[model samples]
Structures are given as structure tokens and as C-alpha cells.
Target: MRALHIILFLFSFLFSGFFINGQEQLTKHATDSIEELVQKSRKLLADFNIKESLDHTTKVIKYAHEINSNVDISRGHYFMACNYEVIQDFSNSEFHYNEALKYAELAKDSLWIIRSLNGLGNVYSEGYKNLEKGTFYYNKSLEIVEKSNIKTEKLGPILNLGWTYIDEEKYDLAYPYLLEAQKLAQELEEIGRIVAINDIKYLLGRYYAGKNEIEKANQLFNEVIKAVESLEIISVLTDTYKAKSEAFQKVGNTDSAFYSIKKYLFYRDKLLDEEKIKQVEIAKANFSLDDFQRQLDATKKEKEYLAKIARSNMVINIISISLVLLLAGIFFFYRGYQSKKKLSAVLKEKNEELQEAKTEAEKLTNIKSQFISTVSHELRTPLYGVVGITTLLLEEQDIQEKHKKLLNSLKFSGDYLLDLINKVLKISKIESNTEKLTKTPTNLIELSRNLLHSFEYQAKSKSNELILDIQKELPGVLSVDSLKLSEVLINLIGNSTKFTENGKIWLRIKILSLEKDEITIRYEVEDNGVGIPEDKKEFVFEKFSQVGREFNKSEGTGLGLSIVKNLLEMMDSEIHLDSKEGRGTKFHFDLTLEIIDEKGENELNPENSGINQKFRRILVAEDNKINQIVTKNLLDLIGYECTIVENGFNALQMVQKEDFDLILMDLNMPYLNGVEATKRIREFDQTTPIIALTASELSEVKEECMSIGMNDIINKPLDKNDLRNIISKNLLG
Candidate 1:
């Protein structure tokens, strides 16, 4: 989340950078209509309307392009790439960011270019696959801006450098850059820059607070609230409130602290609401509200005609009856008049009803879409807990090879399940046009490693390089989401891997300009297997589109690039392609990211200390030999005694039969699963613990196990650390 903030802040800086320096003439003010769309997109990104946000940003970029407005175009890509970074589509982000840089450079717009470079750095540092290169690009950008005489650009680089230091945990090193940025921000009289200054101050304050420097922290907090007060913009209100809340929290003012958090949420949502209202108004103004009434009036006229026909028909009928005696020999006119009147009345009523139904149906469809997207977001947290725990367990060194393999397999399956769930969620959101996006600080290096671990086998089978050319100078953590952005990379990588019979795939990163925020990340999945034609590039992003090729149809659902396009679009990023009809293929795309301040370069490395840890006697309760062997091996490595029993019933007998520190039970035992066995074990030995092993999808299944006196439940594909961590946190810790 801190990383996510860095990315967002970087974007803000990049955009602001465009406002300063020699490139000031590059359309700071976009056209009203496109700007209106851009505003809606900002709101949508806030609301997690990833699809809608992308749709709007795409329009903004197109319009910017149409007008040849370099600044607006740069801003368009800068904002769009944020969401793409969140969704893990580094390639697309790289493409659009590069395009934005091109525009900035074409106009000789250093400010916008600086922002684009910063953004590119963020993508590599946080969103894409290169961190070392990310830092390099970010530094290069800083150097360029330092000489530009643009205080804003200079301030941005200072802030970014400070963050890189902080991420590296060089607190002393981070302070000076931060101090400089704060001073520059004050000099510029910019509320946005001031808001950022307060954040750095607050973080610094937090460090001081952690060190018990209450006075210094309090002074910083004072400045934070002051900065908040100076910014009237509601968009800044969330941070203002949150900063105050944290400050109050540090001061031990609980009521004020809680109030601050509440206020933060309120203002955060309020800003979005205001944007939505404005969007509604703008959309409304685009069309005359009176037009519906005009349609109603036309319908009314038709109804009046029908009524007049009825009246005439009734008169005709009466006249026909009166004249029936005279015209009985020759009249079918009365019958025809009666039929025409009924037909006209029926047709008018049916048409009106049909239109009403269509309107109602559209509304319901929208509601359903919103509900699904909302629910999917809610589901992510719990899934994270399950997957996270499983992953941590696989890292335990004390575990034996057999159990380790089992844990590894389980982890793979769990990841696969998570992917499936995410795919379903994303597809649902996309189909309904209601996908949500959230940006946070992400670790590009760690994320890329995980991607390799997750898909290496699949790649290896095809004999592909699955290459990553990472940069060294990028911010250690840039604000983005690893999950979504990884999704993009995975899609592109998958596309390359699937198409290439036996070829190498590449993801390349570069910094286009240090003077601007544009950091260009190039993803070229060059495959010796096959290539795409230049003509197909434009239409490839269309939903479910597959370039018309005989080999392509058998490869995939064809939504990979479409989803990629949508993901990038949501982030206010653009995509480009260069592919030949033959000579193999190289696919590439770029985006302009908003370069944010880096506090430090962080190293993510977990500890492994088995010798210091102690394991006691454990009672093994499993109905199957295979599971028992897996458990026993893991237990033995961790230096725990295990008495294996074939069934939960026997485990209970043994538990009542003897004393043990922990009991491992299978959920699907012959006589009873772990739940029942634990319940039985609890009859006399309530103090002894039990853990369940099952392949249940629901984490709530753990609750069921615990409800029956089990200590914890380990789902099938058990990780030793799910065992160790559970033991450690619940028992050892």
C-alpha cells in the first residue's frame, strides 16, 4: 500500500512537472469535452471502475491525439498507466508511457517528458519487471530535471530520491531530499506539492514517534494539519484526514484518531460522489433532457390520432347501423373501420410498453454488473490470507523433501485456484463493464520472481527464455498492485509462450528521459515460432479478437490482449505494437507512468531460523498413509514426535490414551474427518490441540474445525509452515 501510494504520488508529480519549465505551452487545459471524460475516469479509478476508467481515459487520449495536444496526451497516458500498473500489465503501460514521452519530446516538452520518465521508472520499479533499471531511470530523470530550472521538476526528483533512500532504510539519507522538496514545494505555493510535503513530514514524524521523539513528531503533525487546511481540493482531503488521524493516533488521542479515519473515508467517498454528480450533469448536458419529452410528445400525437380514429370508427359504426338498412346490399366499410380502430389502438399501446421495458431492462443490467464487481473486490482479502499462509509455509527449511514437494504442489494448486477466481472476477467485471481498480505500492522484483516461480514449468515445457531484463535504479517500491499488473505480464508472456513453438520471450525496460517523468519500458516477446501482421495491430485490442490466423484459433480464448488493452486503458495508459507478418514476431507496448518519490530501495528477504525453534511431541491423526507420511516427514524435520493413527477415531482413542502437544487430523478420514475427531478428542483432553487437513475451498471450513474444539485447520495441499506458523503464532509466540 505504501508502494501503491508512491506510484500515485509519482504520477501526480509527473503531471505537475508538465506545468513548469520550457514546455508550458503544451495544452495545460484540454478540450472541455475530453477533459470532462478524463475527470470521470479519475473518479472511476477512485471507485475501482477499472473498465469504465480505461474506457474514459482511452477517449481522453484519442481526443488529445486528435487535437495534437502534447501535454494533454502526456497526462492522458500518465493517469491511464496507474491502473494498468495495478492490474500488472507492464507491457501495455510501457507502450503508452513511451508514446506519451514521444509527444512530450516532439514538443520539446521537458516538463511533461520528465513526468513521463518518472512514470516509466515507477512502472519498472513498481509495476513492470525491472527494479535495478527502474532506479537507474528514476535517477537519470532526476539529473535531467535538476538542471532544467523548473522548481517543480526539481522538487519531484528530490522527493523521489528521498523515497528510494527510505525504501533502502537509509533514514538519514532520505531526510535531506525530503527537506529540499518541502522547501521547494513551499516556494512554489502549490497545494498538491504541499500535500506531498506533509506526507513526507508525517512519515518522518512516524519514524521519530517510533523512536520516542514525541516533540519532533508533534511539530511535524502540526505542519501536516496546516498543509491539509491549505488545500481546499476534496481529492486531497482523504490524505489530509488520514495524516491527521495517524498523528492523533500517535498522540494517544483515540477519539480524534477515530474521527480522523472516519473523516478520511467520508471525504474520500465525497470527492468521488461529487465527481459522479458532475459526470452525470455533463452527460446530461450532452443531450437535451427535453428530447425524451419530445419523443413522448410524438407518441402522444400518435395516441391522439388513434383516439380520433376510434371516435370516427364509433361514429361510422353508428352511421353504418343507421345506414345499414339502406346499404345492407353493398357495405363492408363499417366492418373495415371497426377493425382499423382496434388495430391502431393496440399498436400504439404495445410500442409505448416496449420502450418502457427496454429502459427498465438496461437499468437492471447495470445494477447486476455493479453488484458483481463489488462482490469480487470483497472476496480478495480472504483469498489473500489463504494463499499468503500457504506460500509462507513452502519456505520452511526444516520441512523434509516429500512434505516440501507436497506443500509445493498444494501451493501451485492454491495459486491456480486463485488465478481462476481472479480470471472469473475480471471477466465478469469486463463483460458487465464494471471492473474496479486499486493502486498501491508494489515490489516489481518480488512480483516478477513470483511470476517466474508460478509459470516456470509451463514456460520450460515450451523451451522459452521467459526473460526479464531488470533495471537497477528504479524506486524499490512504486505504488501499484502486483496482482493486476502481473495479470497483464502473464497475459503477454502467455501469449508469447503459447505462440512460440520453441523460442525466447523478452521483457525489456529503459528510461526514455530523466528530464521528464516518462520511463519507457519495452516488452518485446520475440518468438521464432510465429509473427503477427502490422495490419492486425489496430484491431487486436478489441474484445475477444484473435488476429485472423489458422494457428491462433486453437491457442486461446483470444481475450488476453483485449483484457490487456482494457487493463492499460483503465490505468490511463496506451498500447502500441510492431509485429511483422513473418521472420518470427516481436510484440511491444509502452505507457507513461507518473513518477513518484521513492523513500528507499527495499530488500524483501524472509528469515529462516530452524535451530532456535523447538518442536514438541505431536499426535498424528490421519486416516491415510500417504498424508501421514507427508505429515510425519514434515514433523520429523521440525524435530517433533509423531504417533500416526489411521483414522480420526483411533486418533481420539490415542489422544485419550496419551498426552501430546499437538494432533494432526485429516478432515476426510474413514470414520470421521478432523472436526469430529477433534470433538471426540476434546471429551477429556480439551487442552490438547488438533489441526485438520482437507482440500476444502472455504477458509470458513477452518472455523468449522475450530468450532468442534480443533485448534486450527490446515486445508489440503498443506504447507509445513501453515503448521509451523499456526503453531508459532498460536502456540510458540
Candidate 2:
């Protein structure tokens, strides 16, 4: 059954188109305009618009050696990394920082490499919030500072580390670094640094105050005020006053507390105003980029207009090229035809050859499936141990709080491993021609949110931007399984995020039409990533399909997008791609939004509305103790009644003697498993629902369940939600 699910889910890939279909003119001016955009970015960098400068640096690096500029190449990567850090894109910043470091090493510039490493460390610390790695870089930067005494240059890393410690709430640990940073700031006569140092001092006072060292805390705060007065960095002077007020208020001075609140607001407003100006500049830079791209597109259009004759000649040349290829294909076809004629005379020989190959392939496939099934089950056992033991370990009285966190991480990793194994099994099933989807009316809004949260971590890792426009305005839920739709979106979003760095992706919803009886919702995932080539667009969404190797290679069974296509088609929806070679890509699809009557909705989602009034008690007949434990846990979570019976005969005896609401009879039990027991029970009672729970991949199981008057069918690995949903639908209907 699982294998069938995978195969059906991947079948659409075999039928999807294999080439780009949009009609557009390719022009020369667009080419030149793209060039000018690159050139202009170099000038912007030189003009001190450093962020804008960094944004276009990669375009120049694309032609680094051809343009004969090693210095630019090294500087470009370094500068781009610095900009990425500003926008909180730690991964890309680290990646580019490493690139810059490599180029700097090739250029034999220890100074630049040191700078790049420092930048890398800073990004790790602030952007990714990785203090340990940040400390490593700061210590290295401190080494350089100690040797050269580069005045204010070394203070950045030291201060960053000190703040990191402050975040950890370790005042005693932070003091030494803060004091050293303060000394350096004073020696350099930097007013901004001096003010920041005072702020840390005030933080120390607060920390000590909380420790009940009242006098010590007051003394520290007094010294911080004096230090701030000495530095006279007016921008932070108001904050100093506010801190002083808080210190006084802490000593039961209400008047001072009110004064501090006012002082804080004054400084906060000033800081916000300054930040607003910087943000405006950033907005302008982004606007300029968009405007410039449009201009480039226009230039390409003009070039096409000018090169009309050249384009005609190019078309003729392409036709000639096609003719040559066609002739070559004909030659091969003739030879193949002659071979087929010979094969016709010895058809039995050919059939035998095919038979031998097919048998060998089937044997290999069976062995592969067996190997995967065994390994996956083995791995699952350990993961379950980890999850269970970790759960128990977390409850220990002697476990340190910090160690508790480490245990949580361990459990999360275990679950992650189990998840990966399941994904591999799913992909293997799809590849082996065994997959299917349960057709149903699924609410897509809820589904989209689930997938979004799931892939939030993926987008975060790439520093990729995601925009969602799905809203409740979308009517009529779609005819699809929410879980399957979520899986499809996860696959698409994961791909988009991976292929693009520091770019935006959008999952938008548009209602094409809405009526009382029907609604159509368009769901599209768009990304500013490496787009498909004109000739290879549709080929990308096929089974085992992957794009250009040179375009940021990814490793996975290339079945994700293909599975999405299959699942969507089964639900009677279409997925599309709109893109150019270098611009980006957008995926579009529409789903039939289902609208159920108000009363029907309540009946369909009984448990969801907390309106299940049917029998809550259920009897589960299972042979495996592990399965029993899992079943009990699921039942407890959902607030249900469950009693476990080891064998079918025991379950039958229990049912014969007592009234049971529902019997979750498991097949392959020790004595007279599900089907036979169900038959015996049905002879006496016809009203009670019997749900078959099994691990078999037999088609006859569903038929057998129905023949014995069983309410529904579900296969195992212990699905809790499916159990609840099935039971609800059965009782409600």
C-alpha cells in the first residue's frame, strides 16, 4: 500500500511537458543593458554607497579574470559579505567571507584575510547568535591587536564578546572584557565607544543590584554616571541620566523612576529618528535597483528592435542547424529500423534477452527494498530509545538546567534522524513504482501555514526571504490531502531557498473566482533564484530531473517537484513555472476550493469542533507491546477510552461479554487475528463499528474489512490523527 502511494504520487512527472513554452523575443540591447548595470554598480561602491556597492559586486566577480582584476575580485567578496551581515544574513556572509579569505590568501594579503576572518567571526556572533564561534574570532582579532596596537580596531570583537556574555547574564564574566574595551576606547578618545562602555557599566550595576549587593550596585552606577559625564557623548547622555534614575528608583525612590522613564523615551525617540534616515537610504537603493533592471529590460527591447535583420539571419542559422540534426536523427533511425527488421526474424531471442534483463532488475529492486526496510526499522528502534530515554532523563531531579537543554537537543537530533529515514523510505517507494494519494477535500489555508512553519528553518539558513499572501478570503477548501499539499510546498520552497542566496520568495494566493457554490484559489511559489533555461523548463519538474550542475548543486533524490506534480494532478490542479535563464522562477497552480454546507462542515470535522458526542471508549486488539504503548499514548493525547487485547480471540471474548464502542482490531494477531474475529463478532452485533488496523500491503485487506461490515480501513506504523479522523467520520456519518 505504501509502495502504491509513492508510485501514484510520482506518475505525473512522466506526463509533464519537457521544454519552455512562452513566446518572447531575445534581443541584443538587453544584453548590453545587463552589462551597463554591472559597470554602474562599481561606480556606486566607489561613491560610498557601500551596501549598494556590495549588492552588485557578484556580477563583477562573474567576470573576474576576464576583466583582469584580482583585487576587485577579493574586495568584491569581502565587501559583499560585510553588507550581508548588515542585513542579518549570516550564512551568505560567512560563505562570502570565506570566499574573500581564499582570494586574499591567493593575493598573499594576511591583512585582508585577518579582516575577513574578523568579519566572519562577527557575523557568527551577531547575525547567527553563535557566541562560541564569535569568541574564537575575537580572540584571534585580539591577537592581531595586541601585536600591532591598532587602537580602536580591536575593540569591536572584544566589545561584541562582552555583550554576548551579558546576554548570557554573566556579569562577572563580562566585566574583564568590558573594562579592557573601556580602557582601549578611552585611550583612543572615541566618544561613542566611551558612551557604550558606560552603558555596560550601568548594566553591571543592575546585575549586582539583583544579587542584593545594594551598596556595590549603587557605587557602580555612580561611577558609570561620572564616566558618561567625562566622555560627554551627548547622543547617549540621556540614556545615562535614565540609568541613574533607575538606580535611584531601585532604592525606593518613585520620583526618580518616573524621571528615568521620561529620559529613556527622549533618547529612544532620537535613536529611532537616526535609524529612520538610514532605512530610507536603504529603501532608495532597492528602488534604484528595480528601476535600473526595468531600464535594462527596455534597452534589450531597443536592441531587439535594432537587430531585427540580425535576428532574422540568426533564425535562418538555427533552422539550418536543426536540419542538420534532423538528418543525423534520420540516419540513426534507418540503422535502428534495419536492426528491428533483423530482430523480427528472431523475436524469441529478443524476448528472452528482455526477460533476462527484467528478472535481474526485479531481483535487484527486491534486494534494495529489503535492505532499506531492514535498515530503516533498525534505525527507528534506536531513535525511539533516544526519544524515550531522553524523555525520562529530562525528568531527573539531579539534571542541571544547562544539561537539560543539551538533552533536549539530543532528542531533537534523534527525531531529525528518524525523519530523514522516513523521507528516504518515501522517496524509495516513489522510485519503486508504489505510491498513491487519498482523494479528499482538504483545507489549504491550514495546510499552507503548516508547511510555512516547517520550512521557516530552511529559509532562515539561506537568509532567503519568504512572503505569504494566503488569507481567509480564499473560499472553498480544495480537494486534496492537506498533508500532501504541505509536502509539495515544502519541496518547492526548499528548492527555491537553496538555489538562491539573499533573495526573496513568495507564496501568494489569489482567488480567480468565488461563488456561493464554488471558489478557485491560485497558490504560487515565486523565487528570485537561478531560473530554468528556455529549452529545459518543463524537464526540471520531471522525475529524476535536476538542473545545471554549475548552478549551486544540491544533493537529494530529485523526486520532490515531480511528486508535487503527481499529487496536484491527482487532485485536478496544475502547476506551472514562469522564468528566464538568469532572472528567477515562479510556480503557479490552482486548486478547486471546496465549500461544504454549514451543517455538513460540522458533521465532517466533528472532533475539530470539539463536538464528538459518540462513544469515546475503544478496544484495541494488537499482538505487539510496542504498538500497544504507542496506541495508548495516542489515545491518551486525544482524550479517548482504550482497552488493549492481545489476540483476536481475547478481543472477541471481551466484545461478546461487554459492550464496546469501537473495536480497533489488528490483523495478523496470534490467535484468529482481525478478519476472523470480526466475522464472529458481526454475527451477534451489527451496529458496533469495527476498524481494521494492520501492517499488511495487501489490496484484499480493504475488501475483507468491508465484507465483514468493518467501518473503515487504515494501515499502520501507528498514525494517531488518521485514527481519530476515521473514527470521527465513521461515528458521525
Q: TM-scores across all candidates? A: 0.35, 0.42
Worst 10 residues of 1 by lDDT: 280-289
Worst 10 residues of 2 by lDDT: 17-26
Error of 2 at 432 (Å): 4.7
> What's the residue-level lDDT of 500 in candidate 2?
79
Clashes of 2: 17
Candidate 2 ranges with C-alpha deviation above 4 Å? 1-344, 351-411, 428-433, 450-468, 471-473, 481-483, 493-506, 512-521, 527-559, 565-586, 590-599, 603-616, 666-668, 690-733
**What would the per-residue lDDT of candidate 2 be over residues 1-733, giving only the tens digit for each residue?**
1111111111211122110110011111124443454446544533324444554665555445334444445656765665455434457678888888788667655445566777777777665668788778878867765665544456556766676676566668777887776676554334344444565666566566656576777677768756755643334445455555555555765455445544554553454345432332242312223434554564454234323323534445334433443453344344434533443344355447557766887788777866776677666654555664665566578999999989988976865675566555655555555556555666566667656766776678788877878766765455556656776787788778767778888888888888887787788888888787898887777666778755658645566677777767766787888988778988888876567554444325545656453347789998777767777666665667789999999998999888877788887788687888988998999988888876544233666689878888775554456667787777655
RMSD of each: 28.1, 32.7
Count the clashes in each prediction: 90, 17
Looking at candidate 1, what is the lDDT of residue 485?
77
